[model samples]
Target: MAILLAPMEGLLDFVLRDILTRVGGVDRCVSEFIRVSNTLLPDQVFIRVVPELLNGGRTFAGVPVAAQLLGSDPVCLAENAARLAALGPHGIDLNFGCPAKTVNRHGGGAALLDEPELLLAIVAAVRRAVPKTMPVSAKMRLGVHDDSRALECALALEGGGASELVVHARTRADAYRPPAYWERIADIRAVVNIPVVANGEIWNVQDALRCREESGCDSLMLGRGMVTNPGLALAIRAAMAGPDASPAPWGNVRPDSSLTTSPALYPIINWQVLLPFIAEFWRLVCARLDRRKQAGRLKQWLNFLRHHHPEAERAYMALRTLSEPAAIGQWLALQ
Candidate 1:
């Protein structure tokens, strides 16, 4: 069972990719979408977003990272994919799943879902540009405005020679709303020959299990869920591996109300264990990210963390108003 980390545009960059992979459970990570426009971007553009490229296209924890690109121009995307391929990312992932208006306004991202023919042409062009051995993958939502063309889009991608597809289980209109249509993935999976990795609304172990059962997808991708609970991938992995019968763990067996088939099989990453990673994250943010954005980054993570851990709730409260990196550092030191 492969557990891949979803490429979250703003929130899950290379920095968080480093810390989270170190926390363990994810087999691979897809870097955030690099927006491609009219011109062919420089090599630095790819490297900047996926710095793991400098480290042999893998995170500090040794998890392979795939560089994802978003664009409507098939030729431009293919040329950029060829350049990005030379960087040796684990794979190249195409994004047709982003729901942002800024993206769709330009006829990129989910906007492409309405045109399956273009999707086929785009994927096929990239497939031809890259080497045979390199894995070319695509991520897509159900549709732009609805699910009518979901299967057609999936088939177009597969026919274009995509090795695999990640379905985000929602329409562009659905945005980031809950109740991801995982069952819709099953429909797409039925029509397409490529491996379909399920994504969206997977916030906990229970959600993961039901998503797996309902979607019939062994490979799942974690996004906001993993951000909220860093140990989510580990927990899902443990749960899939089944229990040791020790009855010893967090959120203990007491999964969400919908599931009763599996015992509380996985162990959770407690607050104490997460501290070191948080510290390292802050250090990296200070050293690498812009000073103006540092405090916001930390609070962004803590805001998500607050949902999974009470201590994080307190931490978010403590850092909520503070924007200076120095002040944030002092507060982190005391924590």
Candidate 2:
């Protein structure tokens, strides 16, 4: 089974990607979307979203990174993708899955699901735009409003020559809600000749196993789940290879005390083990982002991390109202 990191627009930027990839287990990563519009974007624009482009298209930990493009215009996207190809990403992935209102309002992202013909055109154009050796993949939700055209959309991407397809298993209307339709992904994989990767609601080892079984897919993409628990991929592998084989200090899942916090279902990367990565992430966030945005970034990540680590909850509250970098650093150091 292959595990790829999902592209999250605002949350999973390069800083987090670098840190998470450093923690290990993810096979490949798809960078956050670079929206294409009327004009062909400059190389800097692509690099800005996927700085891994400058690092031989791999994270510092040596994980290959794919550049994902979002747009409604096939010609414009192809032209930009061709330019991005020159920069040497591991691959190019089209974003037909983002449910952001800002992106959908512009007729990009999930809105494209409503037009299967257009999805085919976009993928084909992008596939032809870059070198044939370059893999061009597409990520799509079930549909914009309903999943009625989910299979049609999957077939459209396959017909357009996408080497792989990732089905997020929910329509745009679902909008980050619970209960991803994993079985629907099985339906998609049945028709498409290319490999199908299942994504959505995969939060733990059990969830990952069930998603793979239900979707009939070998590849699973980790999104917010990975952000919440950086060790997820490794835990999934450990569970698959030998449920009892994981080393001490890892796979330290406590019993489930509440239905919402099913802590027993997943491994816990102790706060001590996770501190170095968090420090490095903060360093990168400071170096790459604006002064005003730095503190918010750390807090944002902690908000997710809190779900898995009680330490994160304490850290989040300690830094909740802080905007000063020095104060944030001091707080992190004490952790």
Candidate 3:
């Protein structure tokens, strides 16, 4: 079974991709969505999103990476898709799963789900633009407001020549809520001959197994689960390999000295391992963003990590008080 790392915008950048791929089991990685507008993106924009292409379309550690495009215009997207394909990525992926209000308001991301014909036109245009040998895939939510429209969209994408589909198992309205409807993925799989990859709410090994069983999908895609627990992909890979494979130890690894215990005193130690990584992550993010935007981005990740790690709250509290990345780095250095 193929285990793919989902393309989560700011949270899953090159550094995270490098770290997760090095943990040893992901089949492939997708770069965060490149929002396409009027003109084709310059080579540098593609490089910023998929620097792996600089090293032969592979991550720093050599894991394959695909370039993902997000746009509402069929012709513009097709042009950019063709340009990105020339970069020699393993494949090209279309994004119809992002639920951010801004992206949706602009008629990109999951908003496209509302118009099956438009989605089909975009995918077909992109597929026709790329080389016949190159594979074009798509990732999408069940629908915009309800699962009522999922089948039509899935069928439209397949009919448009999508080689594979990754279903997030929730509508754009669900927005990361509980109960990711894996059964909906099965529904899509039943209608399409293309491979279906089940995504969303897969937080652990058992969840991965159950999702595959319930959805009857041959592969899985992971998002927030990978952020809270770095070794999750490794664990899932081990589980798929055989029952005899051992799961990686959780909450025992620490990248910061400030973390006092293997499992910190707080109740959510399992999630604390992510704090150091997040700190380092935003340090890199800060290089590209202004102060306020960087803080907002850091807080967004910390909020997600807080659900699983005790240190995350503490780190968030401490980090929130600092206005500069240097202070955050200093706090981490002391840790």
Candidate 4:
């Protein structure tokens, strides 16, 4: 029951990866996609995208991290993948599932699904460029608009020497919509002999179990579910480990001895654990963008957290009114 953390662009940064890896049950982490183009990427670009490699290709806590690349050009992507492999990461994952209009417009992400042969070329080029021992994998949606060509796409990747494949159970058109067609993933599993990881709509332990049952996949990848419930990986692990096994609640403190035993306590505790990470994230964003831009990014994450974690609302309100990081830290402390 391997659980790989999905590489969500803006949400899953180094800070969050560090936090989640320390929480137990996650088998591996994939860094957000590094967009490649015609130009050679600067070393700093690799450093920023996969800083974990600085400390042995693992998160600060030693969880293995893989570098993921996104691009449409075979030559450019292969060159970048070779350079990244030289950096000594645990693995290299290619992204062909992103649905962003800008990415697709450039023929980078899911847009490649429209040309399965090109996708195969890119994977083959990358596999040839990287070391034979270094694992090469890919993640993709069923297709650009339908699952009709999914088998062809999976077979193409497999034919190109991809060590494994992760199938997000929806077409690019479905984008994060309801009822992910796990059956489509099962279809892909049947056609490919390599490891197939089922991904999509897995928001809880039950969902994870049902996904594996329906997709007949031995592994799984989690994205938005982890954003809403940080403990989801642990829950899935406990469920898969044994029916009698129960995971300890978050916060590292016993529930009975917690300062507040209220049913709502978990959300608050989650916020406490998350605040420092969020603050660090804001600082990193500020270093790369303007203050207004950084605040907008922070607000966006807080809004997502608000849906499942009550403290997110309070934290968002307090941070929305403050421009300085110190003030935000103070407000978080007071919570």
Candidate 5:
């Protein structure tokens, strides 16, 4: 079973990808979506979004990274995908699942689900542009407002030569509400011949088992869950494997444990144990981002980390007011 890191735009950039994959159990990662519009994007754009492309499309930990493109225009997507492929990305992924209002307003993301024909045309065009041996994939929600055309969207993407499909298991209208309809993914899997990866609301090993059973898919793509609990991927990987497989050291979890953690009872990871992760993130951001932007990136990570550790919230509060990256770095060190 493959476990992929979802391409969360403005988050999950190469620095986070490096950290997560180093924690172990991530097989592939899709880079944050590169927006394609009327013009073909420059090589630097791809490099900026997916520096893994420069490292042979693999993180330092050796996990492959796929270049994801988001756009409504088929030709532009194809052009960009071709250029990205030239840089040796491990694969190409078409993004039709972004729920941001700004993106959908531009005829990209989930909005394309309304026009299955156009979506398929864009996928087919990119598929044709990339090397025949390279893998091309697509990620989509159930539908725009409802799941009426969900199967059609899945089939259209598959027919357009998508080697695999990742379904987020919600309609555009449902946008992140509770109770992802994983069963819908099973219905889509029943008809499509390519690998179907189930995504959305998988928070633990039990959740993974239930999602797999309900969606009838072995592969999965994890997003927020990975951030909330950085060790989730490793924990789930251990659970799914035979007893002989190595045990995950970070989180000691078993099937009998609750499937999800309430915020009140969320495990408060010790500040000391988490310090290294925070430090590494700060270091990497310092290397990749401008000095002015580093503090914002640190805040972004703390925003996600706070969900698991309340101390992170306290740290965020301390650093939130700090503007200088060096000051933030010093603050993290003092912790």
Candidate 6:
């Protein structure tokens, strides 16, 4: 069974992938969707979104990372996939699951699910363009406005030569609402010959188990759940190890003073362990972004963190007023 980290746009960047993968238990990481329109994007664009491509398409911990592309044009997506494959990504993933208004307005993402033929055409074109050795995968919601043709879309992707399929388990109209309908993944799995990965509403080990049981799928793709708890992957790994296994004791682990590699192996720690990471993230992000932009990213991360960690709310409260990354770092240091 594989555990994949979802390519959440505007979040989950290279730095986050590096940090999360280093903690262990992720089989592969999918980069945030690279928006491809009518033209083929430049090499630098793909690299900027998936720097691991330059490092044999693997994170520092040696977990493979696939490059994901989002678009509606079959020829353009195929052209971009070929370009990305030439650069040697571990795999290629097509995105038909994004529900962002702007993306839908432009006929990209979940909008394509409304027209299964176009989705199949886009995937088939890209599959033909890339080397057979490279795995071509597709991600989709249950359907566009409903699940009426959910089975049809999954079959289309499979027929189009997608090596694997990832179902987010919600229709385009559902859009990140309550009740992810993980069981719906079984519907896709029932008809498809390829491996079906279940995604959505999996927040912890118990949720992972339930998702596996309900979806009847061994593999899973995690998105917002990962943002809520960085140690979630390791926890799920432990749970899968044996019936007697349990989550790691984070409180017992020593402080990661270097703020780089942890002294322990795949250590699972409490939310408090995230302090050094928060500081390091601010430092690294600040080096690459302006003050306001860095602050925005910090707030965005904290916003997700608040869902799982109480301390994150206090941190967000204190740091929300500060727009400077240095100030955020200093606040973390004081904490």
Candidate 5, clashing residue pairs?
A: none
Regions of candidate 1 where Cα sits further than 4 Å from its true position: 245-266
How many pairs of residues collide in model 3?
2
Model 4: weakest 10-residue lDDT segment is 256-265
Model 3 Cα lDDT, one tens digit per residue, 1-335: 78898899878877677656654457788899999988978999999888888899986556789899999999999999998999999899999999999999999999999899998999999999999999999999999999998999999999999999999999999999989999989999989989999999999889999999999987899889977666676666665657554344444444322211122122222444455555556666677556776766677667766666767778778887677767766777776
**C-alpha TM-score for every candidate:** 0.93, 0.93, 0.83, 0.87, 0.90, 0.91
> What's model 6's overall lDDT?
0.85
Clashing pairs in 3: 257-335, 258-335
Model 3 Cα RMSD, Å?
5.3
Candidate-wise lDDT, in order: 0.88, 0.88, 0.81, 0.80, 0.85, 0.85
Candidate 5, residues 297-328, lDDT tens digits: the string is: 88988888888778889998999899987788
Q: Residue by residue across 71-128, what tens digits does model 6's lDDT show?
A: 9889999999999999999999999999999999999999988898998899899999
Query: Residue 297 lDDT in model 1?
Result: 93
Q: Cα RMSDs of all predictions? A: 5.1, 5.4, 5.3, 4.8, 5.6, 3.1
Off by over 4 Å in 2: 243-268
Off by over 4 Å in 6: 243-268
List the candidate 4 regions with Cα displacement exceeding 4 Å: 246-298
lDDT of 3 at 133: 93
